[model samples]
Target: MGSTSSGRSTGARDRDGEGRARNARPRDGLGRPLPYEAQGVARQPEGIVRTPEQSVAEAQGLLDAGRPFHAHEVFEDAWKSGPQEERELWRGLAQVAVGLTHAARGNVTGGARLLRRGAGGVEQWAAQSGRQRPYGMDLVGLVAWGRGLADDVEAGGGTVDAQARAPRLRGQVP
Candidate 1:
């Protein structure tokens, strides 16, 4: 199911320690690569500007299912099509999703960087603007989760257990 731009197999012949076929690079639990070309996250349907309410539900569902790449697409739609005033909020959420995607693929360094970057944006907005519950969701918790995951990956000497180490994207109603 995975292939590179050149139509070559994405290292499916490679096997992990468990003898399970794995992609050459990092992969999801199922062995799909990062930026997995998920149909869900590729683009938003035309004329669809999802509300924060919609985004919270949609993104949360994807994240919980271990489909962070799909979740990123949902957040990307919000960043691209949602209200201008909430662009930063959506963008930060998207970054968090992408960071999670990176972690899922076992890219600890890249994942940690992105997780911190995304968390900072969301945390900064809350800290500076006094909007503790932007988008009626718990930004503080989400940001902390990202930071915690980043910290774990960063401190790991090498070889992060991404699936086991993944942090939940808690979506609470504010």
Candidate 2:
């Protein structure tokens, strides 16, 4: 509903300063617009903190369901709400999920790059947190998983196979 303030509607559509449609909206992969209540969506929830164990478990469940993007949401929540010390770990995990999402969407080059970056971040997380397995996560295993995906992407010549597989989200890397 864009108006020129002269009791006239902007014909057909209106472009914003960036040349995007003024009324353009965000939608999920399935092409559904965000819910009415979530239109001006906030990136993270406020005042909702979960234990590290809980956060990891929830992310894993989402990943298991072939929804890495959703898993990224859980990881991002943990990054935002959990202790500062564990923030990097959560952020790294979220990055991995996002990388997987990109691969699922056929952005192999971007996905490979992000996956490698995330894997490195987890290693940094391990060093900074002074725990090889903080929050009971198998950091090494997760790192390997990300790297493996990146390697697979590269081996495929930067284009992911349509049936490319995603890593599992459960158990230790071993």
Q: Tell me, by TM-score, which candidate is best.
A: 2
lDDT of every predicted structure (CA atoms): 0.70, 0.70
TM values, all candidates: 0.67, 0.69
Root-mean-square deviation per candidate: 9.4, 6.9
Which regions of candidate 2 deviate over 4 angstroms? Answer: 1-47, 157-164, 168-174
- Candidate 2: C-alpha lDDT: 0.70
Could you tell me how far off, in angstroms, the CA of residue 157 lies in candidate 2 after the best superposition? 4.7
Worst ten in a row by lDDT for model 2: 37-46
Mind giving the per-residue lDDT tens digits that candidate 1 earns over 1-174? 788885767655766678977544444442355554443223323335677788787777766666676677788888898777777887888888788777766688888889899999888867767886765677888898899888877787354444454445455435
The lDDT, on a scale of 0 to 1, for candidate 1 is 0.70
lDDT of 2 at 43: 32
Residue-level error in angstroms, candidate 1, position 109 = 1.0
